[model samples]
Target: MTKRHQLALATALVAALALGASGCSDTKKGSAGGGAGGVNPAAANDGLTIGGTPAKGGTLTVLSNQDFAHLDPARNWVMPTMDFGTRLLYRTLVTFKAEPGKGGSELVPDLATDLGTPSNGGRTWTFTLKEGLKYEDGTAIKAADIKYNVERSFAPDLTGGPDYAAQYLAGTEGYKGPLQGKHLDSVKTPDDRTIVFELKRPVAEFSATTTLPTFAPVPQAQEKGPLYDARPFSSGPYKIESYDRDKKLVLVRNEHWDPKTDSVRKAYPDKFVVVMGLKGGQIDDRIIAGEGADASTVEWANMRPESAPKVLPKPEIKKRLLAESQGCTTMLNLNNSRAPFNDPKVREAMQYAVDKEAVVTAGGGPALTEVATSYLPPALAGGKQSDPLKIAPAGDPAKAKELLKAAGKEGLKVTFSVSTGDKGRAEAIQQGLARAGVEVVIDTVDPGAYYDVIGDLSTTPDMSLSGWCPDYPSGSTWLPFVFDGRTIKPKGNQGNNSQFRDDATMKRIDEINAMADAKEANQAWRDLDVAIMAKSPSVPLFLERKPLLVGPNIAGAFGHPVWVGQIDYATVGLKDPAKSQG
Candidate 1:
């Protein structure tokens, strides 16, 4: 999934930190549990009680700069929306355990009785629904509901989610979705409780894919087609009480929900009130102040780098912060289909010329970004590989110039598409590339629509700013989703921005995908990552670290490692429940 980036803090704010906050200790060394580069294991547990035992029965306010893009599980691919939808409104077949560090990668049963049992040489899988499972409306959640939602993922209209179903499921080659009145025979419901899946090929990690929202059940009777984005039928602990699009959303307890069946979500708060469209540092400011009802608030957005000077310096305020790995790598995507960049030498020159150190500074310094050389995050299998290019962090413009000269494209000109808040990073790249005689023109899109604009092949530019977080802790989620050419489509191809579809690369992907042994597959993926970097389809910028600010009176808040290091909404509660009544 595309990782959302925070806006660049103003130069004035940063300058203030440098000049006036000289006595303050560096924020990186003072993190509560883990180092800035790692996740706090204490914060990533099932209970996630960072601030002690959570008091229940209060309204927990969630502040965000952006609104929910798509609430429908079929359209849920991005992290914030996925984190909210999966933990609150819906339940998947299986889910990752809410533990910190490596333990967070463990997959556990959710609505299903257990992780699916694979047969047919890992091609066919079966899952039995938990007995007495019910929807928000108090109706029995049948196996057909799970099958229907998985089927809807293939619909041309609902095209933004993960492509695992279309890529692996048998008999999905010619089928669209149930909207067109075609049933996916590959997904069979032998009874109300039993569901079976027939795959196009053997996938040993198929059970991990079930943790995605694509596997969440949506009863065909309640389906609203495209309008399901407005309000999806709740199958979890919370039901949508009211929604006002980009402004606000209110969720109340699903009276029909039974905690006995759910193990991943604690659902401690009585209600959830999400406030959207608060730009810049507004959410951070409110939480830092901790006044009245604000004391019970937690944020969905990252803490602004500008606010770090105020919050990170003081022991009291710093204690309320959560700085952790997002398991994402931001990069500059070089269009493999477009001119100038389609040439490998030109792409390599751009890769060498771009300064990752400057890019990191533009993004908010070392506390928020770790210079990344490999596309694979350190959290996943095989971990991060050493830089194949062997270029310095400041970049090698001289080597870039030589490469450009050899390619006969020394004076190359290309447009770089960046979202609204990424102007500083775009400028940093522009300045860096100019040193190698390549001119970059900055093209900006609205922050919310950035992915849609760049994702469409028709509208995408020669180069763009993009980032990816694995769907789970697997190399399959990293490479195949982003680099595999076979998955690239005419529209909604958000994952494969680089569009590298070489025959050799595609063949290697198939070979690695076929491996059943986890250890062997991971090693193959690491080797393939090095081979792909040789092609220079994209330039790895940095690994992201999210710093979150929590209200003083908010308790049990932590950055969930599985949720792209965002605060786990389901686990957070009010420290003082009575104050929220104000």
Candidate 2:
């Protein structure tokens, strides 16, 4: 929605905040719940997970309640966007290792021969493409095709895509886009294999930005602009065989892609299929029972809370569930732009009024979540658990009422906007605050459009349910988006949703951003995370462990938190469809 990144999209934290696109929901509808195996042996879910080697062949079905928000490589930035499902069809200059946890540090060459050679005081970066690259259509993948991928992202038509390269690349400042014929002189396609980028400044870690799927190469002839989502040309192991937008998508093997050239994906699944529009309970039940093709199905997010009670208890079901830390922090946005919340005392009172226990129960209890004391989750460096409120993990209503009286808002009425799927969560908050003399009017929207509505400052309720996923693996992703006033926007990846505007805090953020030293940066961000909680702009609710049910039919069922707990698409495959239990 705003400048930041797909990463800024949130990458649905770009359309991954803008990524903040669609989160906290996944595939669904069911009669009952419980996994086929039930006894999951997942270890932090990430730190100790071992899925054993997977066998090849059979279709891997991705069932979802909703459709991907964007597919244009440039426009798709949210965390839960179709990057995971469609990644096998595309290749970026640089990509993350297929590992389930902490993928940011696992940068590896995809199309590029190596990371990137920086010269001219790190202002210029160059990458040489690997030989024998070809699109699904059997055409040689040229460096110009890669260059076009970045250039078209700058087109005004391509709004919501990452502009980091456009903004930072030298000789391109004030360059609007390529639709009107203005091209970035800094990006040079010197040959069929070599691509060079001249930056506006000395950026030591520019290689990280290339890891984004937004940099995925596209052939100019197949470029569909706005309609690219219909079916993008493939450069990876799979190609879109048929696409029905929100309804269904089928991927067949891209015979032209040589497995020897790529190192990450095994390309085991001969076909990948996505069936959307099913409700949560429906999908969970099928997966749990290992019925029909459900054995091949997997959820994009977690098993819905509606199915939580039915699934979390069964010992056998726990075996197939993925309960890993996803570096995501779910928080209640206190819209300071509105009344009651505009008052700091009122915000703090509401924070105290929140019963973490009740909220966590509504969020499927500790089996799938851990109460977050600070906004920083343990997934990031220097993120230690600290309860600033110091009240019980449950909450302190008496203290809250006392604060309410202190603030002269003894009987405040605040409207909370939440997703329809999260109705229990809203009711939980309403009940918690009632004791503190606060009335919460529930406002529920469709889960798919939740962020868009919340981002609109004018229509946004006094309080809203939203979350942040680490774009990369750093506090820089959390602190800046949650507290940095400079990042606040009217719509699209609206960071600082609380409308918090404190000069001292903003200054501290500037200082933190400028700190080049790793230790100093980490400490500065840790300090900032603590300081933000002191303001109580928003309540840090919980850190999530994606308790998704992976069908026994699939061999690699580990959930990848980097993509908002979606399975690592490339690595997962069927164990043995022929010998599968259904």
Candidate 3:
């Protein structure tokens, strides 16, 4: 289970969901203009703009709702830190190209000179460093540093780090982490510049996985057990000047970093001061007010959902509000382990009874979400309204009634386990299903521990609200987490809340994963999304979006295609137009 980001209801209210999300992708309509594999035309970015000359030499104050805890590059999975902090300082072997606006996030080489070359059917891979790379301290970086940094992350203390290497590297399964002196022999340092990885199996999405700073080089001499998070060494444009725990953080230019050595980052702001510990509402108000330094500040945390109606109508305020898919598909997971839900007809009936628009409205409305029909967000190439049951998001209570009657379970008592915070949406679902004569009972769980309560197969509730944000930009992230029965586990972040353990589905996922080309693999996964949805195991509610607010004096702000919708922190600079002209 990925540790998961939280900010909104449970795991999302604290963190943004769009990691490799879409741009101007369709939000309202499902599967329009010719059927299979067809996506409607792209949507206009809701007041989102990108690409401008960045003026330097001012402090960019970030007004955020959340405080970042992870500092060790390996442990950075949270959105605010991953997008705004670690990504600026820790250069990965590969990173997303900094193209602004729609469809801009493409994987490109960062520390390495090019995308890795795969051999032996992608089981073995190699990356060669570009000449001359230095850390913040001007120490020369070596392949051994990358190997050690990757290997040491397996240490128990480094538990929450990205696990791509552990999952894909050959012969690393049973080995203890670096604390126990367990080296991943599969990762070879044949020379100072070249590093090789021997994988247990062909991992098609390995390049995407490398974008995580988990593969960033760490000097063995500077292993400051727990203190590293506060003052991590910089390999990118910024270096830590000072960090006051949960209070204030200031990032200054890393003198050792040269613009010629890096292509992705703009390194615009002379300094970045991240002010922590403002209530969500307070931060939201400050962004709109734009007072003094607040004019230059941007909140990576989303705007208040309560403010949606107020700010929505005002055209001036609307320009600064960016509402885009954050690469997560929020859905209702129908637990297959339960009795009534175990019946296929019952599951199909439930799927037909769902009113996606109503659910999206209850959750936050179009201001914060796009309705979802398939498991994947529609912004992706394969994501279409290819529900396997052919169930439209618009409720079909008569069809649901017919299905329920055919199943010999007319007027069945269907109990749902939903988040207490989502009572309005649950009631919407309950009301819609009630139209079909299905008695929908709402069992509410605490928002903070909803996944825990519902995820427990022991006390498994009939249905629970859940979501899946891809770890990387691939169908492998979206589909496998929810459908691959083999990946399901108790007390873990299992998106397969339905407890669906299908050997056939797992086999198909494996077959698709084995393919090397991304387009082919993603297309296969997209088709699989439709096939799986046809089964009606889980009902997708909406594609999640965060209505992020941008401040006035901030420049070069655009959503990095992969890091959800966080304004590109590296390129963004603080300079009032009046001041910059002088």
Candidate 4:
């Protein structure tokens, strides 16, 4: 069966399970256990009690286990909560428009009044900003602000400065050297409301690029340095009021926001609060205890059949299993520059030794069928191609042994570096490799240090466990960022940790990049996938399943195509038991 069909079947099974489980609940119970009961009327006005009805002026507390290393959009990567700050505080010019067969919800224009078509041979793009736009501090947002923010992303001192930003604006007349820390010659603000960008080559994903938070316009007059980090000047519907590290983050409605007249709905909660550092078990306890209401992120493995069924009362706190389109495919990236892995047969043998299904199933959740045939996930809209890698049929231990013996690297001492925070996951992987006769040395480090070490490709351990969620919903985001040798550096680029180098793959990537049409571009992406898979530089493991638990009142809380964590905050409302079924 096709991978798409397989995903469809998986989704159907999960949905059916949810329906069956929820149907067994008692409807007449006034105070539904597990925080399903309607909010207290008096508490609604005070905004102090969880599960209270919507009030125009109360703090909505949220909890996150991780802390933001940097609030700057360019540096921030983790999502659901990280995005809360970005989406609430900053506004991007061109948002995604809803497109069919693209996996999830489509993108539409967010801040731009109207999106312009490419001109000057697909190199120049002109955007018209909406009139009367104002920043949170009441400064008029002009076209100049957009130009400055885009230029700032290429600044030398910034932690997450994008190399591609320079290339995108390379051909423009004014902003030429900023990417290289010289005078810019490419970006131009032609008028008060007009901003034009010139590119070195035709960029097909230019519109989608605008959705990036780094492109969000910041006031030119806003103070720089430490003050900028503490006090963020923003234009979105909500503004950060206060943040207490490890406790809570409070946000208040931007009074300047006009939901209906401003095109889209403003932030729903009068005040938004995010509770910090709650453990996975603590989150489940809170949900069952009827203390915390609204959404919380859960690790899929932690929410297994045995644990979840016991922790959560069967019918009240209903488990809404969401199959994330963006697969978090974990793999062991080999440093081919090193011995043993330098040989293709050795790498191929190692790939054959791995049981992808066993690893995936052990990780818990559903049995993943659409396993990684390549670097890109199979369900990704445009990434449907045959893997070029000659993988051993199912479980071929005999062939694996033969290949390893032929390479004369039968007993190689391989060290597998695993992150410390996720010890259960790390141990599972270590045990799996051991079964295949691979001498696995587990090098455990803290999550933060682990990421830092991996980022520096020169210091990368022989084989390191790594995973990726797409920056955007395309195979282009996956391949070039991870496998393309051009991006792999002594200090890694955004995603290329594998440090893979191949002339044939690079040639195919260039061909796909040159293809102008979207359909043609997608086909080229598939061809590139085939080339990368054959090398076995990295083994595709499993797609992560994000289980979101929401109250019945919360509607349209599923995943979107581009935006990772945005629920329709505007339309979501408290349902009245008098008018609706329990």
Candidate 5:
């Protein structure tokens, strides 16, 4: 959900369709190989593979430019961090399948016995824990642990995670989190094995939301509050052995993790060593070179666009490339509650002022970006929706000017807050707005502090570069998380950054949630998107196709559609253990 970087519609739509497919099958032809360059996708695997039955022992190295923002599940909201934590450090009630292609997005049981059973007209959900579920230290995982973690997420101190629990859970209107010695009656554990959620509204697709890290179990006894971000108690295949903040994090296999209880993770590698605070260019060069130790490395960050030219021409390195649809849409979030934007006409004008082609070029050209038309990318968009604003890909400056003139804000000046790394994109936006007779003052923030700065409502500027990918591939995940008025907070996690708190829109969200037919609900969500964009809450920028590079000796490498198009950590292993830093 972070503004990182983005797509073809038909191809990307096919990839998104894979995630919506249910049951024990991965039959769809997804977006893994559909890039502009001749970087073919890897062969499909049955939700699990390491080029065959993967070897059991080796150390897999993960090279990254920066450290994880938050390891605490409650504070985890970004894509790459969730990808790592959900796959390695924690276990949720249900997780998407780890297979390549369509199967990789299917919902599968992890700690829970199965996808939860819903009753009370879908207002109540019940999940039974799989027998023998244990934490890294071999303590039993009880249903109460799940309820406790859910309650902890509501803590005022723990912010930035998904707000689904607070939005839906009944009797939690003003409930402070469990840290205050008060427990949530809405999340009930009738027995050690059974857990029930009493929701205020009927939500048919609630199980998919459980895949989020917020739903991961955290035993209250070991909970360290804010300090837990340093190292969360592990319930998955690996536990933290040592973590030195921005330097490095070494993980060893948790012997207590029962593979039988986990249907998703392969856990092929005995250890994982994450090398952080390295330069992106250095990480890219090392993996492409595939030297000693580097031979068994994979990247936590995507390969830089600058490296594509150096590596693409070589047939040897091209095969190691993983380019796929991330199922994400990058956009500019205009603060709706603030002046200039508070006027709907001014917000509408900003949408027409964006030259997507220029923005796409700054975002690394056609291969990496598709000029977006809706907040829901074409993949989950069902079908092509109308461009109500009559948007031109190159931008309709005249239309923007007309709207600005009508609003009496024709030479509108606004501050654009963007990450230092994304200066090019901000400049392109500045130019595009200038053509529409709007002057933009560029405010560059450090890349590391960008989200935290903009996420705070008091410090947020007039406009900021923002993006969203679904928690899962449903409109339910898309619309509610980004546009729901209730998600807006004063200090942390301004999920609805636009701050468009229309009572009608919020009512429609509840209406769509109540629909039992997935197809009907999906179409309704699409229609609602058209209605919302008409208000111009934010500008739709582009859909993304991510390019990931891996070392030659790295096995089971695939661009996980559900994991922000990064290499799947759980299934990855070392082809030659001797070549690894074992």
Candidate 6:
């Protein structure tokens, strides 16, 4: 079985076992609207404004988790937090529109006016740059800069660039050569405004690559040293004024930025501040005391009605909450390459023992029923409320016992590995699995050691709890990384740490990948879910919902799965005129 298949099975099992819990109302409230009290339609408008007016010039103070680990986008593959930092310092050729739709938000031109079609049989792509664009230091952004960024992303030493680049751009004549230390064949800069890309094979999702930060243009002059890390010099609406590492991040308006030309309207606050390291309860207390920070990202459980008084004024503060469908799915990854889990029946039996709903309820919040049916979440696959993938697993101890007996592994002793960070959820999982007659031991480890040990297939654990945050909103990402045969650690090893591999399932995955349209892709993803359900590799846990708290003074603060940490610093503004003047 491929790593993808194992991940899929693990996801399914976690979902099945975690099926016995519930919580708050799951209503279809649209993307978070802006306002002081109640949804403000105008505040959510794309044409940005500060304190209801287009005001530029002011330092926005932001509190983040930590200083970005890497300044270079190519070497960084984490989500919006890291992406947010890079975006301030760089700009992508194309970016998803800041709206909701079938494509979530279709790819629209960012640095480029429009993405050109391939000149030769969909093998070559041409990009025409917008006129008068400049780097932060006043140097013109040119085709050469874009070319350099692309080539650098695929450089031999940079292992952090999205692995998909190697698969998609590898065929581009010059691009393939660079992969093996040979000169690139497909990348070329014809003029200052024009750049072209040649691929070895026709890929329908090629445009998607342009949305990645690695494809964002970088000035050749600033390529050397730790310049990118110092502060942002990109053409974005806001520039990084200062970065104080753990304390704060300050963003100032770019006077050179033209609001009309730029899709985002500049609503620079006098100061936007992010207060980091505060617990959810502490945030509530501070808000109640009228000492709460300007903006913050809080876990969903922390945003209960009880905590509202602390965060919001009794009569005036309005809460606008937006729940984005995350590409992430929490699950228990079993080391199939090891004992106990090496028996397929033992792994399958555990699936029958888990109660997912209970876990969701314990997490505190709404009863999110769209549990993990596959490695990919339902939202990405365009799943409806009535979708079969939403079905919960029937917890049957008898069936689990029978499955264990069938595999001649009646009494299996296994240690369940989970990180200390997930104390509440992991303990619940350990307790739930014990009902299946398995001697499940709970092994807790630090966050760093947890990830390091799990990734090492040679040192596989019996069962481990893991979660996946998608690189993008795509099933291809979830499937291949977790289950693809090629991703396995050792040769001929299917990377199915659960030691569960199925030839038939791998064939189905190929079919899913071949589908061209969204509808086809959605159906293929559902079918893949069903296949994974039958073969349990790991158990799916609950889908996570992150809740955020914003001060009443802050406006235009919205949430997105892509924008995790920062709350759109460029647009968010303080309502108080006094605070606006800071």
TM-scores vs. true structure, each candidate = 0.87, 0.82, 0.91, 0.77, 0.83, 0.78
State the lDDT of candidate 4 residue by residue for 1-582, as single tens digits.
Answer: 001111112223333333333333332111101112432211111101123343233333443554555565544444443345445777777654322124333446666776555777667777888777887777778887777767666554554433456656775444432444453456678798887887777776677667676667866566363345555676878887887765766677787755643544435456556666777556545434433244322221122333344332353454333333334455667777677687888887777776654443344323212245466654443434244554532345566678888888776678767666444444555565555566767787665577667667666777776766555556666677677888766763445556678888787777666555656676677666666777878766555434334343333234333433233343222332221121
Compared with the true structure, what per-residue lDDT tens digits does model 6 show for residues 1-582? 111211222222223222311111222112111111323221121122212432343433443334555546555565554346434556667765543223333556777888566556556677888887876666788887777667666665554555555666645433432334354456678799887887655544556667676677766565543345455356665566666665656665555655565564345464444445555555544443434333322222224435533322223332433234444566777776657776667777777766654554344422222344455554455543112333343356677778888888776777776666455556666666666677777777776566556666665578876666555556666655556545666433322445445677677666666554545665666667656755667766645543344544455554444433224433455545354334
Candidate with the greatest lDDT versus the true structure: 1
Model 2, which residues run further than 4 Å from truth? 1-51, 103-105, 117-123, 170-176, 200-205, 291-293, 305-310, 338-346, 382-391, 398-413, 434-441, 445-453, 490-493, 514-523, 577-582
Which of candidates 3 and 5 reaches a greater lDDT?
Answer: 5
What's the residue-level lDDT of 443 in candidate 6?
74
Candidate 5 per-residue C-alpha lDDT over 1-582 given as tens digits, one digit per residue, 9 for 90 to 100: 342332222232223222222121322222222222332222222122333345678888899888988889887877767888999999999888886656677788888889899999888899998999999999999888888888888988887776778877999988879897899888889998899999887887788889888889999998888888888999999999999999999999999999888877889888999999988778889988989888888887766645665565455776677766677777788988879999999998888888876776566544455567778865466433345566667889999899999999987889999877677778888999899998999998876677778878888899987777777767887888789888887776635767778888999998999876666887898889899999889998876666677888888877777777777777888777777868
lDDT digits (tens) for residues 298-393 of candidate 1: 888766657767775566776787756788777789999978888999988987899877776665555555677777877763444456777777
**Where in model 5 is the C-alpha error above 4 Å?**
1-53, 137-139, 156-160, 179-181, 334-353, 383-390, 397-415, 433-463, 485-493, 514-519
lDDT of each: 0.79, 0.69, 0.71, 0.53, 0.77, 0.52
> Of the candidates numbered 3 and 6, which has the greater lDDT value?
3
Candidate 2 TM-score over all chains jointly? 0.82
Per-residue lDDT for 121 in model 5? 86
lDDT of 2 at 182: 62
Model 6 local distance difference test score: 0.52
Residue 394's lDDT within candidate 3 is: 63
Question: Which model scores highest in TM-score?
Answer: 3
lDDT of 1: 0.79
By lDDT, is 2 or 6 better?
2
Predicted structure 4, TM vs. truth: 0.77
Q: Report the C-alpha displacement of residue 389, candidate 5, in angstroms.
A: 5.4
Predictions ranked by lDDT, top down?
1, 5, 3, 2, 4, 6
Lowest summed lDDT window (length 10), candidate 4: 1-10
Tens digits of per-residue lDDT, candidate 2, 264-349, equal: 87887888888888887788888888776777777764565455545444546656777656667778889876578878888888
Error of 1 at 78 (Å): 2.5
Instruction: Tell me which of candidates 2 and 6 scores higher on TM-score.
Output: 2
Tell me the spans in candidate 1 whose CA falls farther than 4 Å from its real position: 1-49, 155-159, 179-181, 277-280, 304-306, 337-340, 381-385, 402-415, 437-462, 487-493
Candidate 4 segments exceeding 4 Å error = 1-59, 97-105, 137-139, 161-163, 171-183, 260-266, 291-313, 320-326, 365-370, 383-394, 405-408, 421-437, 455-459, 491-494, 551-556, 561-582
